[model samples]
Target: MKRRLALTAIALAVGAAASLSACSPGTASGTELVVTTFGGEWQKNFTDAVVKPFEKENNVTVKQVTLYSSDALAQLQAQKSSPQMDVVFFSGGQETVAAKDGLLAPIDPAALTNAPDLISQATAGLAGGRGPVVQITPMGLLYRTDKVSEPTSWNDPFNPDYRQHVAFTDLSNSYGTLGMLMINQARGGTIDNVTPGIDAIGQSTRAGDAIITKTSSDLQQAFAARDIWMAPYSQDYAETLRKAGQPVGFAIPKEGTTGSFITANLVAGRSNTELATKFIDYALSAGAQEKFVTGMAYSPVNTKAVVPADMQSKILAGPTLEKLVRFDPEQITGNAAAWQKQWQEQITR
Candidate 1:
């Protein structure tokens, strides 16, 4: 399709330009490190918990290039030969793309003092030993208290009563894509054959029941305007919204939830490998992981990171953690692009 082709062209153009600006890794000084990060509240939490502390301890000046994970990956691809970034943070499975492209170096676990504190899956989900998972937040439904009835079945997203008021993140978002997989499997379709899910989306979209928005801030505004009542939402966002006095509550669809694991990766051949590695190690330390989870409501990857008794039911851990719908990262990578294309062609039509 022209859209896909145009996107590819733009990327190629960006890559061509970035190669000129990207420098060789070993050429940099030890005092400066660059990282790609998201903006707004998430960035604030990270700055408080990870960035500020790392800078204080290591005496390094971290220059952040603000970017979403997807944008960061594209920048990496563009600048891989002479990457501007020293460390990258992205969702777990997504790092595999950078790994396959040879943009990420394998992390030395011995360099990480906090490595032993992580849960097995978090440590293992590292794009095949290329990095480490820093934190995780499970994805599920969140709804306004006054707008609609409780959602017991996952099928309710398509129900007529919810029509025109349901908000959804676009499929490009990890939560949105994984949400489709959960719905598909729950609707008796396999990951490889998600026709039922696609059909349901088409039906909802055509009926004008699906209101697609791009970010948490957008969702917050939509909820305030009462244009959206329910969404495939994250626990962290839900908690933040509730604390800010938005009448939001977690909705447990009978089908359960999926985890979105965040990973930290070192750029391949970066000049600041030592400092970059230390930053990652510091992030995984008990102190950092604790702040990351409790401050933002994301579940910590560190086994030793404490979740207070009051917060247990809201976070993924113990019994809730045990019940998560874990998918193969390889499965997602193999299928996601095709799925996104199909979703655009069919569901968004």
Candidate 2:
């Protein structure tokens, strides 16, 4: 969920317009459930793996509104008085803030049949009264294998030879935020004091050694056109670039990496809490998890999901999964605003 104000406004407009369609009577004459999701390929993968199956089993029509996590949060706040959305997807710990703001409803583990199958990492949110973590995307260094040598460390982006060829994601993106935090931590800066990371990256940007990108699409375009040789991005997206025929390689730097735990939460005030919980449970099921793994290359949070050895190498699993550097979601949620402000003023500006 990386974005700036303008893109957010456009997303809100789209949400407002799409909300009208969400209220329409179902032609199938069944229950209707509205959910928030990413657009394009992501929406297609989710529909194939989760939405369509859930719809068939439950006899419900699930309407998906395409919005990044930030805009989705904004739309939830706007509709807080009466939430039109039943299920919402979040990747950047936005669920933490949304839950605290009462925009999300609590989950009952007993209501979710797949609760017992979830990995311990996915169950953390249940105790905090938020939704269970449905999927995970690890952050890592992405490089064009042909254009640059493999990056074994996060500091590789700062190498003088790669100047002007390094793409830095703005903090508005969730992965961007995590990448910056990882670099900041690797450089001896705490979450409360990210100046070291900011200053170091900023020095490169100021010297015209790096290009600041606003969205995942931007990264793809840059890599596709050879505008950038390397960047810090999520592993799932790295696969996207590879499948698109870009010569891409992803690495979990020696300093370690973090991950985006995409969560599916029941929106507060939705009349279809039971149905929404059912959908959430289906998303966490081994069946659906397997589909997501094959369709989207996302790491499954269900311990029972069977990923082949070859496919496992493509995702954040096994030894690579164990290398994840855990950060406090509560701290990240609390400091996100100030960090964003600092990012704009000190880095992007």
Candidate 3:
């Protein structure tokens, strides 16, 4: 049964009284779990789809802390000696670094009943003992349909006709970097080399043909206010804009796109390991995955999760799904600092 606000308040009062009792020092701890999640609409949908159901089924209260992937990792490192969060959600492969630093617990595939239903891509992190990819958002081109014709390739942002109306996501954002890499690869640039992409975007910026946005909100505002007609962003965000009544569309440029995987990991050294793992398993289940697809337009990593026919055209599937380019996480992680520095010195400057 769903806990109503009044019941939750009364339970909190009762719990507080119980905590003060000498015999119940850890009573609440046993029934409470902390998990880190994203903010805004992401958190709302996640709570409705996964958290609430888990809380109801497990008869536990899930305390959700809003933190982006990188910030959440930093918090984990800070709390390593006395970990507070039980489970962590990561969308940018920060789990790779978290696992390396021993901040994340190794997930046992056998423990996850939904493990068998996951697609191969979702299991990519399994061999390395990282968390499973619960969901994915395809990084693609975001443009105003009413402002410009559909973009057929990654190179369309460079068209002179769209001068001063293109937006490039700064290197700090994962999707931004992925977008840059896609263009680079399309023009024959390797992961080891980002100069072609950097130079291309720099030229556009220097010529006043494009603008650089440091965050997703900046991109949204730019498009909303009609300052930018096009940008390389993820599909879910394109939906965000459309829902806001903006005339926008997402396109998978011919060069293909990359999948932004959102993973749920068990935090190391937490007493709630079993419950935390159960939550992770629940998130990977088809029902939870389908809820995310319907609520947030995210592509499911579970093959059994069905997308409605009308929604199928807006998400990654079929040929578009086939076009997913899996980049080396190591390449992105190892070179991120250098790329950021270069972006500042060569592009942002």
Candidate 4:
């Protein structure tokens, strides 16, 4: 029943497709639905878990506009009047921004049959109070299985044994910022008091024991080249690297991990509002969530979504992980810019 499209998943990879311009919004006949998604494995997993199924069920062709989370919001804002994008997937902080800018429409909880399946916290800080949380990829510690003893604590990245070979993402990025939050909580500092985490990193920075990475790709490259033995980062990304034959391993350090939520939002005034909402609901459904976790190694926000025995150890499954740290998107989004400023002035120095 799934009708194949020429471009099932587009890997525009951050402006690779600037040569292509945005199109007009979909019509009332539901002939096509324009949706924006992030590329790479996440896009592929989403296509399999949700997009293809939605297409088959609705009998409409989907035109995917692949954009990074940050770029997706920027595009939406740029094209607000013309409304080329029907729905979008955004990282938590971006979602908060989109919500604040009035870019997202309110999702009627009644329409989302799978709404009740979400874990209590997944609904936090959403643009309209409720919708499908696309995926929860928690930030933790990833280490070189061959060169570093698996890190057992959040502080392991700073341990002198791996001195000068530890990678830390610059705090400008979400995962990097979330990593700091994990360290903050682990070191007995509240969100308001992150100086403990800052001071800890300063010790390593001043001692010349850390390698600062400007982007996620930089961190990955550092790991691949064996220049960094450990980092506080995404578990799924680490899994992706390991599956690609990198000698990497991931763990939720004893202090626990924090996560960034990817959310699907219904655009305010696209003609396909109903279909768009259905797509959002589908992403959070048990079937879709299960697929994302099993197929993509992303954490599930749905309580009913079951993890296969084989993937149990890879997710936030145990009691310890069940208590993993979660950030307030509103608080984080509101303060992230200021934090980035401080990070530039203090940590990155």
Candidate 5:
């Protein structure tokens, strides 16, 4: 439900190749690649599944800085004239906003060997955007299989009997907001207009039927403890839990679930362009994709990579995949302030 942040710090000895490359003409000596990301299980998964392998393969040390996307964006904005971070990973929408604000450098897809194999939608979603934000994972819902019947629609969460048992994340979360938007759309509401869903959530909150949490870990813990019957959750979390033998399942409703792509951006005027490119390539590699799916249960954006068998039958099924609803990031970015205000007033209070 709530967007959780996960941070992983990996330290590896720099390979001679990397060291020599760093010492080259324009590169800084012994520079730490500060990669930013949300903190929690995903961070651990990333380190175990991706970072460790990359560090070993490249023989380079990486220092990770973890913070909420908004905070990172603010820091980047404040230091625009002299950027502090070398690489950043944030929500697709935030990436677009940062790109528009001139905080990111354009990525050269051709530089990545796996770039051509990436899903067309994934590339198209991030291409032509000023920022480095690209969709990293598709969004969906996570629920306790023991407590829920097979859900055919998003409206199932609104069942009167399940009232107070339904936990949801804060509305300010792009993913959570999109979940709400999906519910609205299923009920015949517009994406640009969330008033109907806001009113619905307001009524639920008033009746003490809706539980709002501030973090994804909190929501996951609540669900794991059976404190709530269902909540909109990240595909990554649901997969991780289920793999751990928890009785959880994930789905995208018939009305369609809202999804976003995540992208990494280079800080303006940074001298580590080559290193950044290598990092990106490593992150999107087939081996990395396999580890991501096997360890995190997320679908890889790389088309050539095979999805794990367990997940292929669960969250990666066709029906669930087809229900993913893509939104116009430009419009959402333009109206973010207004949306936040409405969410605070109607859902958070």
Candidate 6:
């Protein structure tokens, strides 16, 4: 009887241990992952769709911190000796800067289960010799249908008549910088060691043709108010406005629009290397990609994920998607500071 009782107690103990092990958090049982990203509606969507589901399934909680890209970069740079963030979601140029500064870990494509499903462009754009830095965003122009009779070309805002009515985010901002670069490219210029791009946009602004805002939300507000006819905008924002019954239309100009790629990178000094990789793998998974498209209205990087019919027809259709000019992060990051200096001096002045 004594032996049997002892055996039963041991069995119970073993079972409890196994149960606890199964419930351990993704980053080695008790450790929580610190994820940094842009806050607001997009963050909410990500939490609802990806973060919550991931936490439940993996038995791990994500502690998300909100910060602008520049501020986040500053924080990360400051903490290089004792990194606080486990993962970071930022623009291609920022990712390149982080990687160059040795603040990021190189991602192994072979280790990612869903890496196979990603499109060639996405993979190529993100993972170069230094490893993946960005997840690509196909960009184009957004216009108000009620005001404009025909689609405006990429260079249309450069015209004198439409100058004052054109609204764009500040060139210091990511989208604005991209828009400026695209215009420069269309005008047969380059952003590398050249101020023509900055000069042109600045001249337009000085001439009372262009309006600049700090955030995409502000740009959307202007569009909603019908204060501006058209500007370079994000597909996701344009979709959000359209869903709210706004008469906004997206177009890819004849010279081709610029595409922005954002990436989630591993922090430099985080101790949970295995867990960080797991989180990145899960985020880039096919399921997560599908959620990004369906819930957030952003295009999926995974080619295997099927985009909704309506979204595909409305946003990804025609020559627009085909003609999108993918921006080079290396070039952009190399010149970002100089561009900003020129922009302040020429355009804002």
For each candidate, the alpha-carbon lDDT, in order, equals 0.79, 0.84, 0.86, 0.76, 0.68, 0.71
User: What digit string (tens of lDDT, one per residue) describes model 2 on residues 1-349?
Assistant: 5568889999999999787655643211229888889898889999999999988888889989898888998998897887778889988778888898898889988898988877777877877768888888888899989989788988899999998899989987888889999889888998889998888888889899998888988999888774799999988898898889998888888888899888899888766788888889999999999888888888888878899777876787534554566687789878888888887777746
Worst 10 residues of 1 by lDDT: 20-29
**Angstrom error at residue 327, model 5:** 1.7
Better of 3 and 6 by lDDT: 3
Q: What is the lDDT of candidate 3?
A: 0.86
* CA error at residue 59 for candidate 5, angstroms: 2.9
Steric clash pairs (candidate 4): none
Backbone-clash count (model 5): 14
Off by over 4 Å in 2: 1-30, 318-323
* Model 5: lDDT of residue 156: 78
TM-score for every candidate vs. truth?
A: 0.86, 0.87, 0.90, 0.84, 0.84, 0.83
Model 2's TM-score against the true structure: 0.87
User: 1-349, model 6: which lDDT tens digit per residue?
Assistant: 9999999999999999988764543322345778886888778877876688878888888889997777878888887776777888876457767877888877777766777766555556346323342244556688878877555576777766665668867766788888788777777787664566667777877888888777877887777774788888777777777877778887767776766666777776566667777777777776777677766666666666667776674555223343567667778777777777877898658
Give the C-alpha miss distance for residue 104 in model 3, angstroms.
1.3
What ordering of candidates by lDDT runs from best to worst?
3, 2, 1, 4, 6, 5
**Candidate 2: worst-modelled 10 consecutive residues by lDDT:** 21-30
Which residue segments of model 3 deviate by more than 4 Å? 1-28, 318-323
The lDDT leader among the candidates is 3
- lDDT for each residue of candidate 3 in 1-349, tens digit (9 for 90 to 100): 3569889999999988876752332222768888888889999999999989988998999999999988998998897877778888888888898888888888889999998888777777877868888888998899999989889999999999999999999988988998999988877888899988888998899888999998888888999774789999999999899898889999988777787888889888777788888989999898998998889999987778888987887898534454588787767889999998887887756
TM-score: which candidate is best? 3
> Positional deviation of 291 in candidate 2, in angstroms?
1.7
